[model samples]
Structures are given as C-alpha cells and as structure tokens.
Target: MGRVEPSLFSSTSDPGIDQANRPDPRAFWVVTFAFVLTVTSFGKYEISRLTPLFFYPVTIGTLYGVSARALLRKAFFALPFVLLVGLFNPLLDRQVLLEIGGYSLSGGWVSFFSITMRSMLAVTSAILLAMTTPFDRLCLGLEKMRVPRVLVTQLQFLHRYMFLLRGEALRMVRAHDLRAQGNKPRIALSTAGSMIGLLLLRALDRATRVHRAMLVRGFDGEVRVLHPLRFSWSRDGGFALGWILYFVLVRLVNLPEWLFGWVVGR
Candidate 1:
C-alpha cells in the first residue's frame, strides 16, 4: 500500500512571518496609545467619544495587512455578552432622565447603550491589536512592560503549540479519509467517539514529539528569543506624546460632545 501522505491541511500554516520582526517603537507606541485610550474610554462609559479611537488601530491594521473581516468576526464573539448585560438596562431603570421634544429615556437606558457601544469599541481594538501584532512580539512587549516572565513564557508556548495542534489535527483527518476509502461513513455516536479518541491519541503523540524536540534544543521551559527588544528614543517619544495628546484632548478636554454635535449637524 502506498504510504499515507502527509495531510494537505498540514501544509497550510499561519501566514508568513513578515510581522514577527520587532515593529518600530513608533508603531508600538501607536498601538499602545490606541489600546490604553480605548480601554480607558470603555471604563469611563464614554460611548460616543470612543468612536474616534477606532481610527488609529483600524488605520494601522489596514496598513499592516490584518484582515478587517477577521477582526470583525472576533468582535462578533462578544455580542452575546454585550446583549445580555444591555437587555437589562431598558427594564431595570425605567425613570426618564432626558427629554428630546417628546421622547423620554432613563439613565439605565443611556448607561446600557453606552456600555454596549464601548464594549464593541474595546473588543474591536483588542482584536485589531492581536491581528496586526505578531503574538511573539506582543509577548515581548508585555515582558518589557514588566509582565512576569513565567506568564510570558506560557503565552509563547500556547501560541506556538496551538498552530502545531491544528496541523496535527488536520493530518489525522486526512489519514482517516485515506483509510475510509470507498466506505460510506456512518454519522453516529460510535463514529464520533472513535474519531475523538483517535484525535486525542494523535494529539498526545504530537505533543510528546514537540516536547522532545524542545528539550533537544536546550529548552528548559524558557523560551530564548534571539532579538532582544530595544526601545527607540525618537519613535517611542513621538508615539507616547501622540497618545498623551489624544488622552488630554479626548478625556480631559470637551471634544467628544462638540464632535458629536458637529457630526449630527452635518
């Protein structure tokens, strides 16, 4: 019998490592500013003001080749949680706080709407960051920010193994297909059970192999990355200053309401 070929799915790895090289400190600063502003905006319940914050990351991601659709899909996963909390707003807080000609609205309704909007903004910003920043560099950034080395190492391992697990799973599926040639597959509990068992077995084997490879390469459960992170003065300074200005303008200054009024007028 012909040797079972490596699964075609195994060949399809994550996109190229073009994003792995450390981003310019300027780029990192832009992302950091966007992240802090976005998170802080969400925390303060500044719904309308947060809309402008999306532009930074979206612009960066667009330039950096991150998929908009994929980022939005990640945002979609949070919808249920947002809705669950938001639904209570209209029901619990029934007192009318504002009157616009004839429409009456409650504080709860306003708060809820603000929460939902900010939630979407926050989640989208996070997704954009993850998409544009390679996971390893992100961990390095965290390490630089004083995140514990243990946590960073765990994150690095998880990201690397996730891709490996995906490849292994694909190989198992292809092997099953090859073995089941000309047989009508039964869609039943028994078949499902067998498939799960086979998948687990193959996954364990792959993990063992990966662990051995790591040990051979002198991995003592600590990842030693080659490029040590270096902060650039001009780029990082400019980036930080931009974020400081943004925070001052958006939070400290009264810009959001004015911007909202202008948009509505237009």
Candidate 2:
C-alpha cells in the first residue's frame, strides 16, 4: 500500500497567507526561548528535574500544528547518535552512586541517563522549530537576527534547489515505476550508473531551462522577497514576558522538585 499523506492544516486559505505570510515575531521569540531553555536544561545533571522541561515545546508544537509523529520520527533518527554518546558515560565512570529497589547503580548510569535526557531535549526542540517554521521564513528570520548576508543567501539558494532536486527525483522515480510494469527491479551497479547518468542529463536540461526563464525575467543575482518582516511591540513584548516568566519559574524556582515530590509523596 502507498504511504498515506498527512493532513496539513493552515491558518488561512489565501495563497499569499499559505505560501508567504510573515511569521509572527511572538511565535519566533517563544520558539527561540524554548530552544534556549532546552539547551540550558541539558547543562544540569538531574534527569528527574528535566522531565518537566519537555512539556514546554511539546505543548507549543502540538498547538502550532507540527506533526507529533514526524517530530518523534526525527527524534528517533537522532537517537542512535545520542545513545552512542551516552554509552561511553557508563563505560568511562564506573562508581556506584545510587541505590534503588535493592539494586545499586553506578554513577555512570546516572550520567548516561542525564546525557540521554539532554539529547532528547535538544533533538526535540530542534525538530519542533523546523516543523513549525517554514524554511524560507527561518532563513529570513536568521537574516533579520543579523546573520551574515552570504550565509542567508546560501541557505535560501540551497533550500530552493533542494526542493527542485527532490521534485526531479520524484519525477524520475515515477517514470521508472511506469516503465517497470509492476516489477520492482533491484538497483544493480549497471542500472545505478545508467540512472545516475540520466538524472544528471535531465538535471542539466532543467537547469538550462530555469536559467533561460530567469534571463527572460531580467535575471539578477539578488533575489527580492516582497514580504518584509515587521516587528510588533505588543506581540514581541508579550512573547518575551511569557518566556521570561516561564524560565524564571522553571529554572530559578525549585518548583519541579516541590510539585513532583508533593504529588508522589501524597
């Protein structure tokens, strides 16, 4: 069976809104705050306390229409890298640190737990940001935040052509499927070579056509984006205040320990 396409919801039906609306600065700040919080949370060696931090981004992403399954899948992809790093924590430090339920665990185990939790938070926060923000807007936001012009231009170009390349690949796959008559041929060395050659030729032709089109439209090196980003005082202020309060409450106060301990103890 073919893979089911996800049901995507947008805030507006207008094409302009769907394709190129300016992202709210408030949302951007909130996402940024979550990212900073996630990173700071990892610097500590406490696993139990870090559990509460997950709820921030989880709630934000869920409310913002980011696919939870997609986020989890991305998180899982990064899991092996995280686990590999955590694995060394157990091997390098072998001191008994804690005892629970008649079993004594090493300090390495505690360190490993903290490392894993940190990795999860980092990965999840990144995935959440990517899911909520469109690529072009993200680049634009970075540019607004004073990133180098060269880097921003490079990112925009890369993102634009990556989509083009993926579309080309999809077309090639569909053409191959049509020609194969329901037989899925394993890509051997010879077939792979021929496919690569064909794809390169097609890509070159497409690039030529795109260049011609650009020339026809008065081609310039600089890409002009019409929708300029504007900062709203109220939105930005409210967003900043909310995150500041959250950070103070979560990190500065011992609320997690007090709340969780009371509930568990009760």
Candidate 3:
C-alpha cells in the first residue's frame, strides 16, 4: 500500500518521535472538547475575557512542534465563514457599550470581535488536534469511545484514499496537458466536464479492486491497531484534568482583568 501523504490532518511523519510524547488520542479529544465548550460559554461581547483561552492552543502546538504558521494557515480557511456569521452584528447593534477617551465603542462591534475571536480559537484547537493526532488513530479513539463503526470506517477510508483520488486527477490532468501540446493552459468547459466524469469512473473502478483485494486478505469491518491503546491514568488523566481545570478557571476568572487590576493597584 502507498504511504499516506502528509497533510494537516495527519500526525508528524516520524511516528516513533510522536508516539512517545503524544497524549492518548481520547484524552486529547476530551480536552479539546472541554476547551471549546468553555470558550463558547463566554458572553457574546466579552472579547477581552477570551484572551487567556488562547494559551491552550499556543502552548499545545509549541510542545507538539506544530508551527504557529501552519496552525494559523489552517485556521485562516475558517475565518471567512466566521466573518459571515457576524457580518450583520455591527449594523443591528449600534448601542454604545463602552467609551475610550471620548470615543464610543458600540455593542455590535464588541460582539463581532468576540464572535471572531471565539471562532478562531475553536477552529485553531480543532486544526491543532488534527495536526497532532493521526487520522487513523483519531478514528480508533472515537471507535473506542463507542462511536458507530460505519461512521468511523467511512472517516477512515475518506482520509485514506482522498490523496489517491487527487493523484488520479493529477495524472488525468497531466495526460490532457501532454496531448494539448502546451497550447491550452486552461481546460475548456466541455473538457473539464469530461474529465470529471472520467475521474468518477476511475475512482469507482479503483474502489472495486481495492474491496476485492481486502476480501482476499480477510477484510473485517473492525479497526485493527498494531498496538492497542493504553490510557495511563497518571499521565493521560492528568493531562486531561489539568486542561479541563484550566478551561474552567479561565472561564470563571478574567485573568487579564485581574492582572491589570493587580498591576494598577500596586
């Protein structure tokens, strides 16, 4: 079988290095879920309060050696949808909520900013999870958590063969280019349609052959892992508990405000 191409959703290319340091996938998922839930619990206009929640992703990504640039790049794709979600807030909410040196801050803008920040944080956490956790491992973790087998299998196959489909499409494009004699840089509408249909046919054929091969190899619907996942209570449990407590604390206390008050009070 061809190696799975490295992508944002796959773990680091070196399995040995990651396997030792990586937290249990199930624990990581729980921590991520808790963090996201805590983030959304903040009020709609409490943008400043959400500042402390940013530390989780930053710290985790740093420890995992996942660069901030890559995380931000992946998170950038979700910003457009985030913007659309809050696009009408500024217009609908014109009430002045605060003032700074003769300038009034409108409630709409505050809410809009809050929405944007919360969304970016949540999206970054999810992307970070995908970056650190291998897709197969993630599916396995979910299966262990009692997720439906069919759903997990579908996710597994989708992540597994997406690159193969892309490769096939690339080959078709290359063949088209070779026959075009370098005359057409862009494919015509009709040619593009034909290519799409042909790709679909090829993908179907490939799936059939793969299924037969799997059957010959004693294929079963269960996800089989080389090493069974062992969740260490002292390590993985501590990891999850520590993060969950931090999330709760950050949610309950506005650390930025408290720090600022202490500084000024001194």
Candidate 4:
C-alpha cells in the first residue's frame, strides 16, 4: 500500500502574512467586493429567503489562507450583540413561514437567523481584509481612491492608537489583578466604572503628552508612507474590473441556489 501524506504536511506559506507584506493594487478590489457582498447579504427581498452568496468570500479567503481562526473568533464574539438586537424579531413577528424537520419556523426566526448569518459573513470579510492588508496600506489605498488627506491621517492615528489603547488597557487589567484578592474574583459594577474612568484619564493624559512631543519634534499634520501605493493601471486595472464584475454578478444572481438547482436537475 502506498503511504498517504498527512494534510498538515501539505502546508506551504501563510497567505495572510504574505498578502499583507506584498503591495498589490488587487487588494483594494478584494476589499470592495467583500464589502459589497456583505451589504447584499442584508438585502432580503423576501423575509424567509436568506442569501448564501456571502459565504463565497469565506471560500475565496480560505483558498488565500487568511487567519480563519481570528476571523471566526471575532465574528462569533460579535454575534451576541446581533442576537440581542434581533431578539425582538421572534417576539414581534409571529407569522409562520415554513416547517423544517417537524418544527414550524416563524418569519421572525427566519429573519433573525438570516441577520446572524449576514453579520458573521460581514465580520469575517472585514477580518480577512485586516489580516491580508497592513493597516498602513489600507490607509494608502483610501488615499489612492481620492479620500481626504486629513481623514486618512486621522485613520492612521486611530489605527495606531487602537494597539496602544489595547496595550494600556491590558496593563491596567494586570495591575488590577495583582492588587485584587483572588479568593473573591468578582469585580463590582461600581468598581468597574471607576476603573473605566481611570483608564480614560490615563489614555487622555498619554495622548496629550504624545501630541506635545510630536509638536516639539517638528512633526507636521501630514501622514507619510514609506512605500506609497504604486499601481500600473495597464497591468492591474482589468484584474480589478474582473473581480468587480463578479461581485455585480453575485449580487444579481444567487449562484449557490442556482447551482443547487442545476445539480438536482430541477
């Protein structure tokens, strides 16, 4: 008998890191397509008819080896808010839509589940974008698209601060944990509120000092990129357009449903 190779042994490169390191104009198109697809997921012509086309991004993303775990984690972590907001759907709309596996499903439940699916797909698409494109490149891509310079600079600062803020918050949490009595692990709401206030104060203080330092260092308000966006439209324009066309097609046609029907010979 021939020896079979393990699936893990077939791995080659990490696509997420590779994509982020490579400066490609095509990434903008990919992000645009993903966003368009996500938006279309919410456009339900009928309450019961949920779109499965959104999953196409996941399929493509996996092929390109995006960080599936991080994407899935973020999506799932954000799902409770979607569920909580949509909770009233089942209560408010009681009209029965269809029967599935001996159980009746109402329109509200159908829509609720559909919304959940949409959120998951949308969030996954965004995570894939972040994983595949460096934050600086994304801001540059925005600039290439003729976005305002001030807005792009603000975005860059905001992106930089997201990491700083998270790091600061973690340090604060660690300090809190060190002082806290492990025997009684629960933190009261009032205590949490005070902690939050303190965190904000520290964050503001740090921001002011950083701003003053930047001013002292002869820093202007312009955001400069080491490797600016370089695009050869003749080479990459058609490639972007092709993806855009596919996006439009997907929005117009429910490819999954059509394929299923074709496969079943309906």
Q: Judging by lDDT against the true structure, name the best candidate.
A: 3
What's the CA error at residue 247 for candidate 3, in Å?
Answer: 0.1
Model 4 lDDT tens row, 1-266: 00111111111123325443343634554546556564555553233233545445666566555455655665687888878867888898889887989999888887787777666666666655555566666667778777798998897777656555665788888777778887656666888899888888887777778778888988799766576666656545654565566666666676777888899995
TM-score of 2: 0.75
Candidate 2 stretches with Cα past 4 Å from truth are: 1-30, 37-41, 178-185, 189-212, 215-219, 261-266
Against the true structure, what is each candidate's TM-score?
0.72, 0.75, 0.88, 0.79
* Of 1 and 3, the candidate ranking higher by lDDT: 3
Candidate 1 lDDT, tens digit per residue, 38-59? 4565543345666666666677
lDDT of each: 0.64, 0.65, 0.83, 0.62
lDDT of 2 by residue, 128-199 (tens): 655555555566667777778788777766655555565677787777777765478456578778887888
Query: Candidate 1 — worst ten consecutive residues by lDDT sum?
Result: 1-10
TM-score ranking from best candidate downward = 3, 4, 2, 1
Runs in model 1 deviating more than 4 A are 1-45, 98-103, 171-201, 260-266
The candidate scoring highest on TM-score is 3
Candidate 1, position 201, lDDT: 78
TM-score for candidate 3, residues paired by index: 0.88
Point out the higher-scoring one by TM-score: 2 or 4.
4
